[model samples]
Target chain A: MLKELDPLLHSQLRLGVMSLLMSLESADFTFLKEKTNSTAGNLSVQIDKLSEAGYIEVIKSFRDKKPLTTCKITKKGIKAFEQYVEVLKQYIK
Target chain B: MNDEKNLTPQESLEVITSMIRQAKGNMKKSSFYFLLWGWTIVLANLCVFILIKFTTITNPFLVFGLTIPAAIISVVYGIRQGKQITAPTMLDNINRWQWTGFGFTCFIFAFFGQRIGWQINPVIITMCAAPTFLTGIMLRFKPLILGGIVFWVMGILSFLAPVSWQFLLASFAVTFGYLVPGYMLKKTEA
Candidate 1:
């Protein structure tokens, strides 16, 4: 039997965020926007969805008096990403 | 990039690979500390060699006092750089701890070496090898690994050399151990 794909991570931008977070300790809003090549408004919506799903934690703070948003994957997110990849391999192979 | 579109499995994998590559590429490092320490060590070794050979300086160890300024500069530089980055990678944390450990070990060796009547220079050269080697492994930079091995070899040679000449071996060790690899790290991204 094939595994079901993670609906939370199946979309392109969310998966891109997850993949980037997987490799890094954490990344800021600007960094994620740059890497995802997404506009602020759209990226914010996707980030909120992922946060609501408990796949990522968003930390808002200030750097040099400028507001900063940093995102990191949760343990639940990692498990979901791994399972997503495993299921993806089944489809691609 | 399409933010809301569904991705095919192949496109999904591609996005994963590309994003990971981009993150890795964004890893920032400054060669300032490496070059600073490398030049300082080389100069300290040379200063000792010069004082012992040409001058009638009674205590050549006074040259090592130069490290006081180097340490101050290091601390200031570290603080400034720490403030600059919003996020530090896991590798960055590991590197920081490893070097901090090395710094403590060196202090311990220096403090105890005199009491134990141990030759400090040769022992210091031996101690230098561990951090350089482990750093190489962490960064996947081969020159640093070789440089670490060079420190060990130089350490052994320093043991065989006469007391005054151990300074010369130490000079060679830092030349290869820190400066060469330091420059290479500055040049290479990975």
Candidate 2:
């Protein structure tokens, strides 16, 4: 069954970030930026949005003296992703 | 800063949302390696467990606890994985650990068993404790990390327990390591 998606998460870029997070246990901002080929500013903006949504968590900490920003999928984020995939699958058929 | 900025609050929010969605898509495309590789480690560990339980398993010392034999197997396994299980960032950290947790578990049990006899270490607890700890930090989950910490502390304290205490540690290891966390993984679906 196709389920409702929050309009906020349906955007092209934001959906990309959430989709990545939903599949992974965690990832860094740079990795996400590189994978998406997104500008740093744009990636930062997207991460902030996901963090704000409580769909994903942004953990800021230091490792080996470097400022580190890591992201992980929240339980809510997983549910949203499963629902998102189900909805998208409908279009494939 | 506010006066120079032209975007309305709602407009900015929408922009951010769209950007995140795109990033999520990219992430999905890149993570196939982790899912496949991580599952392999989990499966291999389960296989070893089954093999040991079913086989003659003459040497409990070699088969269970912190044994060098198990660590040897893990190091070879971990090294074989090489870059496929890269753990450069906190995100990759969990992936990096892979089967190394069991390696440590094998080492602790092996060393302890040799001199101290076939007793479980209370503080050492679960062989997977260290890996779980890394996962917690990488995932930014406090409870999971705390659970690892508790298991580790238990491992260290195992040495202090009387002869009977070894069994207690073994039981606790299963309870905290596989049972509790397994339940959580199922319930939370995380």
Candidate 3:
């Protein structure tokens, strides 16, 4: 029997954000917005959801006197993403 | 990027794969550093060679003072480029540390140059090989890997040659090791 997918990673924008973070050490807010093709409002909401779930770490700092927000996948998020992929493979099989 | 829309397993996998690919960034901008350092080193090497061979210069090694400005330019440009970067890849971090290690080692060598008889040229050439080779491996770019090998060979030859000849060999090494591969890297991106 296949396990249930993590609900937090089931949404399109959240999953995209997670996937992108997995490949990088960290990424800033603008990068996520451009890559995911999501509006800042939508990306911000999804990022907050991921941060609240402990699936990602959000780092807010200043760059050149401007506010900068960076995000990186958490350890728990990696496990969840891996498990999601495993279940996904099973469904395809 | 709809927040409310749920993705099927297949679509989820697709999104993951695509995003990962997108995050695997191109190192095209990095070519600038290689080219900058390459020309700087080359010019210094030739200048030293000329001064030693013909001119009555008390300290031909002073030609290396050129590196001070090159180092400054590199730091300023690097900081500006770093600010613009949104996605910072693991490879970028590794590359930065690798070169930083190289810089520290060179500094240590320079500090002890008088004590060590200033025979650090051959060893410096050898040191250049490591980062160049590893960077090529990381980028999977064969030209740079070959360039690294060329540096190794020139480094060994420098050890065997006379002190005056060492500068000439170093110039050749930088040409193959940094300049050639750097230009190729830029062209590949274009």
Candidate 4:
């Protein structure tokens, strides 16, 4: 049977962000922005969506007297990502 | 980067692979520690050899005081680099803890140095091998792995040689085990 693709992870920018965070322990907002090549507004919105879904944890703090935001994938996010990849493999097959 | 655009399975796979590659992060900066400690140890060993062999100095071990400044430099550099690191990997944590363990072991040996007598050089060289070799394995750099083996061999040879020649052997151990591989790692990064 074919599995349903994760709508939340199907979009380009969010998927890119998730992919980046999957391998890293945690990543700065600037790193995500640079890697995804997304505008700040769009990246913030997507990050907020992921945070709301509890797929990623958003940490906001101060670094060197400036605002610093870092993001890490949650356990739920890892499970989801793994399932998504498994489903992807089926599609490829 | 289009937020609304859906990706095909193949495209998704590509994104995952590419991002993982990007997250691999260059470990080349680690070569700094290898090179720093390598040169420091080499110089300290040479100084001890020269002072004991030629100079009238009663306490040749004073040369080890150089490590105090090296430790300070390592700490300051480490903290500054830590602040700059946006993404720390699991391997980074492993490498850090491995060296921290090694540092503690060295202190233990120093505290017992008088009890151990002249055999301390061989024991220290043997101690240096574990972290150096394991780090090389973790970094997947062949030269470092080989360097670790060299340390082990030298440590054993130092035990066999006369006590007076042990410092020279120790110097050779760091030269091959740390400095040579460190330079190779730096060049590879460059």
The recovered share of true contacts, given per candidate in order, is 0.77, 0.04, 0.95, 0.75
Candidate 4: where are CA atoms >4 Å away? Answer: none
* Error at B68, model 3, angstroms: 2.1
Q: TM-score of chain B only, all predictions?
A: 0.86, 0.46, 0.93, 0.89
Top candidate, metric TM-score: 3
Clashes of 2: 35
lDDT, model 2, position B167:
50
Off by over 4 Å in 3: B188-190
Q: Give DockQ per model, in order.
A: 0.72, 0.05, 0.86, 0.77
- lDDT per model vs. reference: 0.85, 0.54, 0.89, 0.86
lDDT of 3 at B170: 97
TM-score of each: 0.89, 0.41, 0.93, 0.91
Give the alpha carbon lDDT tens digit for every residue of B1-190 in model 2. Answer: 1112344334434444454554432211122222332233334434444554567655433323233333455456555544232113324544455545554555556566656555534434645577666655555555557767766766666666664445545555545554455455445433
Q: After superposition, how far is residue B167 of candidate 3 from its true place, in Å?
A: 0.3
Which candidate comes out best when scored by DockQ? 3
2 or 3: which has the higher lDDT?
Answer: 3
> Which lDDT value does model 2 have at B108?
59
Q: Please, what's the RMSD in Å of model 2?
A: 14.2
Residue B77 lDDT (model 4): 83
Please identify which of the two predictions, 2 or 4, would achieve the higher TM-score against the true structure: 4
Please state the error at residue B103 of candidate 3 in Å: 1.0
Model 3, A1-93: lDDT tens per residue? 877888888889999999999889889999899999999999999999999999999999999899999999999999988888888888888
Sorted on DockQ, best first, the list reads: 3, 4, 1, 2
| lDDT for each residue of candidate 4 in A11-47, tens digit (9 for 90 to 100) | 8888889988888778899988988889999999999
Residues forming the 10-long window of minimal summed lDDT in candidate 1 chain B: B25-34
